[model samples]
Target: MTCSEWADENFYLSAESAYIEGRWETAPFQVAILNSMGNDEIRVVNLIKSARVGYSQMLKAATGYQLQHKKRNGMILQPTDSAASSFMKAHVETAIRDVPVLKELAPWFGKKHRDNTLEAKKFSNQRQLWCLGGTAAKNYREKSLDFIIYDELAAFPEDVEKEGAPTFLGDKRLEGSAFPKSIRGSTPKIKGHCQIERAAQESETDFLMFVPCPHCGEYQSLKWGGKDAPFGIKWAENNPRDVWYLCEHNGCVIRQHELTPHFAKAQWRCHKTGITTVDGYEFLLNGQVSETPESVTWNIWTAYSPFTTWERIARDFLNTRDDQGKLKTFVNTTLGETWDDETGEKLEWENLYARRETYLPTIPEWAVYIAGSVDTQDDRLEIKIKAYGPGEESWLIGYKRLIGDPAGELIWQKLTEYVDQSFQHASGAKMSVGLICIDSGGHYTDEVYAWCRQDPMRRIPIKGASVYGKPVANFPRKRNRKGVYLTEVGTDNAKDIIYSRLAMQAKDLTKPIKGYMHLPMVEWADELYFKGLTAERKKLSFVKGRRVYRWECPSGVRNEPTDLEVYNLAAVRIAQQHFGLDLDRARPEGRKNQSTKKRKSVHQSSWL
Candidate 1:
């Protein structure tokens, strides 16, 4: 019989009238379920829809169709026994009392048990609809039904190892008959669970509803809630008007207009218009039509009622700006798209690149060179070799990253390699070998100091420099004196040199000094500036007089290779003091005899 005739005889008269007058859209879900069941080829069907979207009514319709046309036992599983009872009372009982056609088909409709089972045999077609709680472990054992409907599958409880109750029931239903068609439907709870599973198994006949776009004729699924669209009201203006016409494509110019036929044909196109596989189900299930709920749509079926206007949304987006006049976090979370960071501060990659570019090529050859720096975990040693030119330019030449933690024999080996390479690069450069800074800031500091004292490499004239700004005399006195001839210098003095060079470079930013001798120095200096170490200061006491403030270490936390830059600066200072490479003019008096001070402990400073 026609839907109108069947509805008139079996359902509420008002429902029949609504159907006849086209007041309701033909429940696409009902047609999908019916077609899948009648064909016998589709054994599973899963439905998902927004809340209050007439899913229950569609299920009732499906139940009526099954009762009128086929003799088959089916089970309807609800998340709880209470819900199952409510379904029976609201849907099953109402259908029996209100539908004359269903009464004729099932004479025992009102006379069946409401708790677990209902059976009717008086009609021409004998069938039963059993209700069960989804949590009941034994419910599947009691039913050899041709059909099963699992509702609210998202909340089904099961062992974490197993799929869930819906899949468990689906497996059992498959055992009943090859032609059995089961329906599972629920709202999504997570990315990889029941909704995802069922969506994975859908077929072409599986109905996915789409509202056409008023412009561009594209079919789009509407996204009405979540962090992006926090206005939970489903409609645009909250006036029971349709508001589903926003374009999903980035940079689309379509705006919300009154639902019209011309606009309907332009927006909202089905994602699976020609595809024919269960695999395509995932695309449709996860797809959202609008990035925000206030989007415009064609008037096919208003997913949201009482719509909000686009102008208000745009204005809200604009007004919610940060102190910088950029969108605030709320705007980013709601309308503007930006990656969220847990830390309040942003790490600027451009700054890192800029610093690296500025200091990589300007190191000079005629200078005193020394490699120094600290090491972090995984041999990531920040080593820098500094050389002084004829003037104020201190060339930070060689920066090396040694593998592994900063301590131990491996570091010494890498240091040796770096020194050899640096010396070769600066061959014949007349510069005194001064202090090689070694950071003695942690547990390994004593060991490093001891190694510097005991190793034969001490004879190579490499002085140990500390990273933290402790006095050079404060470090532990060395007992063994047979290895590398090491002298300790306060890192404060080293930082002084670095900051001085940085100040000079900053002053020359507008018209940067040219030549390869200036490039690496400028680049390293830029890195220091970016790190906020634009200057260094030190409070000192003269042997006979008053306190004095001298340029100390550059300000800021020392990162990788920054200590190396300090070592380069120190070497340049030493070369200027002794070798004259960093001096502005020839010393009137011949260079004073460069006396070697006792290898004092290099004070650790915080410059690096």
Candidate 2:
């Protein structure tokens, strides 16, 4: 019998512990996952689930079944040592004490059992069950196992003791067993980072929890509101408890009270059409897709949970709609899906390079204004020069890297010379940088200030503000200890605009009317520039029930190119607003001496 079947036959819920016991039949979705343990072909079972959905209970029941029936050694890994110990104490011990069948067959059920402890338990027939933390050290190298269970996989650190992913190491323990099984489960946390979601996407059979409609009896998965969703939870203007789920098939209203009856008829549907079974569990399919039998992955949301109510979920959604933190929790624990803090496309170096133009680092013909940005580093300084045309259209005029210590004058001199130099425009007119914004949030703060004060051009010291959802430029927040005024740049706002512009699918190097990033020739475009441009991604993180947008870069990825471009864009903005640079107006032809003529006449009138 499968683990769920075994639980139905023997496992009993303690009144002090469970609201419902021996109710495996209620969660038909979990039956296949639990039963797959006995299938030698299905080596791994992954459950990417929502919170309070009996996932933990299922794991505990599976462990108990393995100890009694298979009599095989198994290991269960939690997120941390403390969590592992708590699971052993609260759930494992209680199961041995309360379950009548476990007490009758397991040798360690009694109080005087010598082989049982908090971490490890010895069962009849020399069987053993070990409860270990995800980071419980490499001590398991010597221990062989028949089965492995990884719980709360998203919470496990990317690295354990600098060795590697904890789950990867846990699988090694089952190397000695011929028919080893690995069960992975977790409530997903972050997009692109959730282990359970990753495993599910790679699984051979991706299963979604489905329930039959009371009216038409057509099976469909419960959907949180989306473009394709026809039926969803509808509530009155002011009453959350007045919630009802709409059936897409029949357009019938399934009241909150109707969930239990419908849940009894729930089943797991295969995404692809085929007739298959994993050790007697039925999988219905419709397409002519071939099956690769190796792993079975399941996804379950709280919408189908018996312990939860539609009204309560609606109320929670209404309450958390305005707050990021609560909304993230609602998505992860309620919807059983990862939340995108900021929905945007990831930067790819190849894609950006594919749009490269033939123009060199020199200013383009459409140039109306030019700006410079510098990013300071310990060993070098990164510089980016941009030229703006009509409608805020811009091109990467030049890029330079000056190697030296920021504390020394070697790199600073190079930066000064670069900014002072003039680039010949397509009109044969010389155009120097109209504005230069050097980052002042580095060790060279005082140096940057002193240099800006001495510069004869439009150079200014600037710092990035930590505030989110603000304008790209704001009034100075506070001055440095040296009494130097610094322009505060809203990096989050700037990045949002930059990403939006980068997302534009341009056919050529010509800039778009509204917002577009123009790239230069192949000489100026390289792999490193593209890497920095697409290095960081916008991620949504929750704090105190509020959503906080974070610009995160993976470890070992350099984001200096992105930083330099942001500051450069900020400089162009300052020039447009404060310096009266008309980015939308084209520079007039044969107007090189217009300003000079006015100045000469004014000088003659003053002499009179």
Candidate 3:
């Protein structure tokens, strides 16, 4: 069957009415694209759209066309099972029931349940629509498919290399077809993935629904401008009449113009231009859109909904305001902006204490030995002590927010004393300092690093710890020594382990260990998971032929406390591995104290 034949048979005239009613362009475009795809000349079609522009319906139309006209296996893969079910139930069923041609062509369409599989037949050809999740992509390589649809392509898991690429799946489906057409469509979610690949393959069309200028004969795309464009309702208020139009070119002296009787007769146009580029989407410092030299075409579809009222958006901003008058999720997601600093309210210290208290009693007696992390700064030191069992359970024993010059000998004295005192409190078997992960992140790290490199009375074990693994060396023999202990620690490598452990634990959603309860850590873990950086590994590179490793922190935040927190966690992990501590056991034998006053002195000077 030809593309036009299929369109004439099944495409609904109501689709045009929907478009005219300023509802969604999905119904019309879906029918049009399905008609185009039935042609042998069209190999692929890409759709780029603003939010809520109805790409889902278009996808369903393409799927329906394949089922009715083609006699081959079809597949639709979504990033998740839930999304696939929603798409099938919403659009596929709508097409089958509402479009009379499809109901007559494929009798089984609406009868299928929203499960893993759906089957239908038209004439003598058999068609199957399987909604598989991303995980099943690799296992289906043997199936010859006639059609493939990737839904919510951007939100596809980052491990596409493991899950398998949608393009590869689409190609595999087209293998035996005499005339195969693969249609891809998605809103811009992130910078890369299926949307990017499809956009790269096709010529972009600026799908502007135009309105005629009242005073001039020119018909152009309409946009909110100046005080008329003021956020939300201001644009509607300034232009009172919904007929205002402006020239697309910036810096044009043209002002607000009305639609006149003669000019209103022109038709809306969708111009085929070049592909959309990343730079075309860049916003200016003041939050206005910027114009760049790169000429990329966009199928720009503005919302048919009333111009978002500035008052409405402003009220949304005010409603989400924190104590500091900052809009929490509004400024980041709605405004399409980035933050220069971490502006959201930090988790309250009291809340952290409360969560910690609930989990404290479960600490096993055998996990008495503690590992400490010291994040050194010029003015103050951030210290964290954690207790771990032989297996998975770990606890945050104690953390100190200490003040005073971190570089001074007195801080080290205080740290050493704190360690000794903590051991004394846990006195039983042996309470020994297993590992100390110090942050050599700043310019003055050398001084503290040298101190850590020094032997601690043959009692407290001080190992040189990196993110990836631990490297051991003797304590500094002299105070002025600089060569041996100073080494670049890979922060990324350490964070990878910390984040992986946290992710695994989060998936279980069980209560955490008792001694290590910290509300702040839980909040940080949540943020990291939401940003999809939970198990992300560090990337290694070469600059000037020298090896370097880097880490990307979770999105929507900075990397200070998280870095320090991971450093501490890594130290405890290393300690557990080194000592063969049984993390799974309810109680393990505690470490025996080998420290005298000298050990105490060292502890006081290092971390207090």
Assess each prediction's global lDDT (C-alpha) against the native.
0.43, 0.73, 0.45
Clash count, one per candidate: 69, 8, 50
Instruction: Write the residue-wise lDDT of candidate 1 on 471-577 in tens digits.
Output: 32222234345433344555555554444444332333323232223334343345543453332234322111111233333345544443445444443444334
- Number of the predicted model whose lDDT against the real structure is largest: 2
lDDT for each residue of candidate 2 in 1-608, tens digit (9 for 90 to 100): 76777877767665445666543442655666677755566788888888768887778788778877677889888888899888888777778777766676666565666688777887767878888788756645677899999989888877788887776788888888987989899999888777787778877777776777877788778876522246877666678767777887887878756666776666666665344443324444454333446788777888877778877777787777666688888889988888775466676788888877776645656666778899888788888888777666678888898988888887788888988787876655667777788898888777788777775236668888866676676535455565554688889888888887887875544333556667876665688888889888887754432446778788999998889888988888876666566665543443243453332221111110
Candidate 2 Cα misplacement greater than 4 A, ranges: 20-26, 110-114, 226-230, 272-280, 284-292, 342-362, 365-393, 396-424, 427-497, 500-608
Query: What's the TM-score of each model vs. the native?
Result: 0.41, 0.64, 0.41
Measured with C-alpha atoms, the lDDT of residue 202 in candidate 3 is 51
Ranking 2 against 3 by TM-score, winner: 2
CA error at residue 302 for candidate 3, angstroms: 3.4
Question: What TM-score does candidate 2 reach?
Answer: 0.64
> In terms of TM-score, which candidate is strongest?
2
lDDT of 3 by residue, 1-608 (tens): 54434544564423422343221232222333444444444555554444334445445555666777665467777777676666555556556666665676554554554332432223224456666665455535666667666665545654555755656555676779766656555444422233433454454333334444444445455442333232112224323333223445332223232232322243323344322122222312234443321212224333222324334443444455432224323423334222223211223323333333333323334343466667666677766666654443456655565778766788778877765553432222334456666666665565665566664322222233444343322233433354333323345455544544443323222433333323333432344322332323343322221223445444555344555556555555544444454445432133233344322322211221
C-alpha positional error of residue 430 in candidate 2 after TM-score superposition, expressed in Å:
7.5
